[model samples]
Target: MMTRLVTDRLMMRRAQSTDLEGFHAVVSDFEVVRMTSSWPWPADRAYTKTRCVPINAAHGMAGPVLCKGEIVGIMGALSMYDDGPELGYMFARAHWGQGFATEMARALLDHVWAQYDWDVIKASAYDDNPASVRVLDKLGFHEVEPTIGTCKARGGDFPLRCFQLPRPPLTRV
Candidate 1:
C-alpha cells in the first residue's frame, strides 16, 4: 500500500500519475535540480514522470509534498548506501526559506523509525547549499564525513557533506 504522511501544513503521499505537471514544475527549475544528485539538468518531462510512480517498498518510500492540494516538493528515503537509506528532498525554488523541508522530513523520519528496524538513516548536502545543510541540522542529523558527489544536473562533481541520524532510543510506554 502507498504510504501517506500528514503534518500541520502539508500532506505527503506516494506520487500519483496526476502529480506529473506539479512534480515537473518543481524538478524543472535549474536552481532546484542543480543541487540534486540524480535529477538531470535541462529537465526531461519523461524522466520526471517516471519518478511519479508511487513508491513504498522494503528499501524506501517517496512521494510529493502537497500544500492545500498542490504539490510543492518531493521527499523520500532510498537505500542508496550500505549503511542505511539516504534521505533526499527537493522543492521548487519558490518554496525555499519556508520550514516545509524540515517539517515534512521530521514526519517522514518518525514514520520510518516507527515502522522499520534500521539503525541509521543517511543524508547528504552539497557543501555550497547551506540551506539544505541547515535543514539536515534541524532534523538532528550529525555530520558523518565529506566526500565528492556527482550531480547529473551540474554534470560534474561537487563537495558533499554526509550526515546520519541514528535511531532514537526506544521508550517504554
Candidate 2:
C-alpha cells in the first residue's frame, strides 16, 4: 500500500524518483543541511538517488513532503525505535518558518498514534536548530536531555537535544 498523510497545506507520501531533483535542491543548500544530522553538504543528484532507494522501500515509513504539488521535504518515523517511535522531518529552506513542518508533523503523529498502540514519540534537534525545537515544543514534546551527536555532513559533533511526547492516558470504554 502506498502510505499517505495529509495536512492543511501539505501532503506526505511515498517518495519517488521524481523527487530527486527537488530533494537535492533543498539538501544541497548549505544553510539547509548545516544543522541536519546525516545529510551530506553539496548533496548531489547521485546522493539523492541513493537516499531515495531506502525511502521507497518498506523499511522506515519515510516519505516526501509536498506542498502544492512540489516536493518540499521529507518526514516520517522509524516505526519503532529502542526508545519509542522516533519522528523526523526536514523542509526546504524556502519553506522554513511557514509552519509546514509543524503542520505535517502533527498530522503524521496523529495518524500513527491513532493506528497504533504507542506510548511515546521521540525526536531530536541540533542545539542550533531552534526552528525544529520550536516545532517539537509546540507539538507538546517535553525536552529530555542534551547530548553529543555526529553530523557526518559537517564532520563534527554537535550538541543535540532530545524530546518526547507521551501519549495521553486512554479513557475507559
Candidate 3:
C-alpha cells in the first residue's frame, strides 16, 4: 500500500520495496550522510530495510518525500508530545539548497495538523548545519534550545540545536 502527500512543490509517497536501491544510493553517499545521520557510507540493504523502513513507515504508512514521484527525500516526526511532534528530514545531495526541505517540512506539518490534530512539531540538526536551520526557519520553526545528545552513529556525544514548529490553533486545543 502507498500513500501520497502533496506539497507546494513536491509529492511525498510511501517508499516501496523497489525504492531500496535508490534510497540506499541517496542515504549512503558521503556528502549526504556524513554530517546528517553520523552514519558513514556504504550502508547495506539490511540496515536500511530493517531500521529506516520501519521508522518511515510508522507515519500512517507514509514513506518519505518525493519530487515528481521520485524519491528525493524523507521527512517525518519522532516524539509527538502535547500534539507537538519531533520532526526530521534528509534529502539527496543533488537536492540540497533547492527549497525541497522547506516544502516537505510544511507538508508534513500540514499533514499532522490536518489529519492528526497536532499542536506543534520539533526537529533537531547539527550545530553546523546551516542549511537545515534555514529550512526549518522558512517553515516557521524557531530555535528552542541547544540539545547535547549522543548518537550511536558517532559512538559519542554530539551538540545539536532543537527547533520547534507550532501548528495554528484551528487544528489543536
Which candidate tops lDDT? Answer: 1
Which of the two, 1 or 3, has more TM-score? 1
For model 2, what is the alpha-carbon lDDT of residue 119?
Answer: 73
lDDT of candidate 2 over 52-137, digit per residue (tens): 64453323467788999898888886654456578888888889889998898888877777666667778999999999999999
lDDT of 2 at 77: 69
> Order of candidates by lDDT, top first?
1, 2, 3
Return the candidate ranking by TM-score, descending: 1, 2, 3
TM of each candidate vs. truth? 0.94, 0.88, 0.82
The 10-residue segment of model 2 with minimum total lDDT is 52-61
**lDDT per residue, candidate 3, 63-100, as tens digits?**
56777767787666655234445777788988898888
lDDT, candidate 1, equals 0.89
Q: Candidate 3: minimum summed lDDT over ten consecutive residues — where?
A: 53-62
lDDT of 1 by residue, 1-173 (tens): 56789999999997789999999999889999999998998989989989888775676778999999889999997674566688999998888999999999999988888777778889999998999999999999999879999999999999999999888899111
Task: State the C-alpha lDDT per candidate.
Answer: 0.89, 0.80, 0.69
Clashing pairs in 1: none
CA shift of 120, model 3, Å: 2.0
Clashes of each: 0, 0, 2
What lDDT does model 3 reach? 0.69
